[model samples]
Structure formats: structure tokens, C-alpha cells
Target: MTNVLILGANGQIARQVIAQLKSSKAAMKLTLFLRNADRIKDIAPADSTIIDGDTTDTDALKKAMKGQDVVYANLAGSNIEAQAKDVVSVMDALRIKRLIWISTLGIYDEVPGKFGEWNNKTLGSYIQNYAAAAQVIEHSDLDYTLVRPAWLTNKDEIDYETTEKSEEFKGTEVSRKSVANFVVHLIQEPNLEVKHSVGVNKPNTDGDKPAWY
Candidate 1:
């Protein structure tokens, strides 16, 4: 069985990922790590373990990462760089190579046209933090895949497309469910796109902003 640890387990995307892991036939030993233990009591899978602690806490992270085959991080916020640094450090110490990280789409200034302009103007430092987090992961020796998702929505549909970091990103909005599906796919197929940054978005929904905006 593949042992997987998920940080930021209480997050919306992470919750979806947990549900997918539970229902899939993949033989996975899942562990959810969050700041609040109570937040995941009811949502975690029957066979899964849940640990509560800050991601920036190295000791807690080291303990949570023990014997894990892969680590998936669904984290965000202004302090994201510090959190990513801790995760990378612990994973490196543990000699765990596989890491799947969630980042934002506009971090590389990859969002084209008017939407790109608006996103940069609106996000300001938030996107900068994400970019820094991505940099920390990239500089690490760990085998990593960074997923940059477009503006996320609560829609249940799974329609989405992807672009490599070197390619021009497409579309404006993608459902959280769609991003979760992609992450689960990576878990099931770890070698599919190792050491790459990929962008996920709804197909053909390109515009100055997401339809909702």
C-alpha cells in the first residue's frame, strides 16, 4: 500500500482529496494533518489517521511524515513560504522524495490578456507569497509536482484543462472538484509528470476574469 500524508487537511481542496482517496480502489494508507483535530474528525476516511499541528512546526511535521511514501500539501496564506520551507526540510530529512503541492495560477505571470492584469493588480503580495513557496519547493531535491490552479469555484463539474509551466495558461476558472480530481490522479500515478509545475483551468472559459466575476 502507498502511504500518503496530507498537510492542510482541513482545506476545501484537501477535503475533496480525502473523499476521493476514501472511495477509490487504490490501496492507500492516508493521514491528514491539520491545525485543528476536531475539524477532520467526521470527514477523514475510516482507515485514515488524523494529526493536528502547525505545518511550520518541524517536530510535529517530522512526526506526521514518518514512514510516508508521498506528501501532498494543500496550503495557502501569506506565510506559505515559511510553511513550505518546513515541509521541504522535514521531507528531505526523512528522505521522502515525492511531493505534490498546490499553488496559484498567476504566480508566474502566466495568466495572459486582461485577466492577468487584473489578477496581478488584485492579488499583489498574495501571489508573491505563492511564488516564493513554489521557489522553495523547486530548489529542494525532492521529486515534486506543483499544481497551479486558476480561480477556483464550488461547481461540481470536473471539466478542466492543463498547461505546463513553460506553456501559456488557458481559461479563467476551474472547479475545486476538477483540481481535486487532478491531484488524485497524480497520487495514483506518481510518475506521470514528476518535477513539473502544471496549471489547471476550465476549458475554453477564457475572459478578463472568471464568469462569476
Candidate 2:
């Protein structure tokens, strides 16, 4: 069985990914790691394992990394950079490569036109924090895919497109479900997009800002 460990598994996108993976026929052994295990205990699959611990805790991370084939981190916080460093360090120590990280758009100032300016102004330090976190993953020797999604929505549909890191980001908004779907794709095809950062967005949704904004 392919062992998969999900950090911050209680997050919306991560929850969606868990549900999708469980519903599929893929032979994956899931380990859900989060700060509060109770929050996800009810929803976690019977075959999945749940561990409650802080991502920055090296001892906790090391325990969770054991025998995992892939690490999908859907984490967020003001201390995101530190969290990224900890994760990378633990993975390197265990020699577990293959990481799929969820990041946000505008981290690289890749958004174009008026929307780019608005994003920078609106997100401010959040973008910086995420950028620093992404940098941590990018610099690591691990085979990683950094998924930079556009402004997130709670929509249930999963329609999205992607852009390479060198290209300007597209559209203004994408659904959390779409981002989850992309993450599942990465998990299933581990070799795809290795060591690359991808920008995900909805087609024809490009504007000065997200529609809800």
C-alpha cells in the first residue's frame, strides 16, 4: 500500500482531499496529522490513522513520517515559514522525498495586471509569509510540488487550470474543492510536477479581483 501522510488534515482543502482519496479505489494508507485529532476523528476513514500534534514539533513530525511514501501539507499560520522548515528538516532526516505543498498566489508577484496590485495590497504579510514558506520547500532536496492557488472560494465544483511558475498566474479565483482535486492528482501521480511550483485558477475568471471581493 502507498502510505500517505497529511499534515493539517483538518483544513477545508485537506478535508476535501481526504474524502476524495477515501472514496477512490486507490490503495493508499492515510495518516491524518493535525493539532486537534478530535476535529477529524469522526470523518477519518476507518483504515486511516490520526495523530494530534503541532507541525513544528520535530519529535511529533518524526513519529508521523515513519513509513510514509508521500507528505501532503495543507497547513496555514503566521508561523508558516517555521512550520515549513520543520517539515523539510524532518523529511530530510527520514529520507522521505515527495512533498505536495499548498501555497497561495502572488507569492512570487506572478499575478498580472490590476489584480496583481490588488492581491499584493490585500494579502500583504500573508503573501510574504507564504512566499517564505514556499521558498523553504523549493530549496529543499526533496522532490516537491508547490501548489499556488488563486483566491479561494467555498464552491463545491472542481474546475481549474494551471500555469507554470515562469508564467504569469491566471484568473482571479478558484474553489477549495478544485485545489483539493489538484492535490489528489499530485498524490496519485507522484512523479508529475516534481520540483515545480504550479499556479491554479478557474478559466475565464480573471478580473481585477475575485468576484466576491
Evaluate residue 85 in candidate 2 and report its C-alpha lDDT on the 0 to 100 scale: 98
Determine the backbone clash count of candidate 2.
Answer: 0
lDDT of 1 by residue, 1-213 (tens): 999999999999999998888889999999899987899988788888889899988999999999999999999778999999999999999999999999998888888899999889888999999999999999999999999999999998989999999998899989999999999999999997899999999998989988898
Q: What is the C-alpha lDDT of each candidate?
A: 0.93, 0.95
lDDT, residue 49, candidate 1: 89
Q: lDDT by residue for model 2 over 1-213, one digit each (tens)?
A: 899999999999999999999888999999999987999987799989999999988999999999999999999999999999999999999999999999999999999999999999999999999999999999989999999999999998999999999999999999999999999999999999999999999999989999998
lDDT of 2: 0.95
* Local distance difference test, candidate 1: 0.93
All candidates: TM-score: 0.98, 0.99
Q: Any residue pairs clashing in model 1, and if so which?
A: none
Per model, state how many residue pairs clash: 0, 0
Clashes of 1: 0
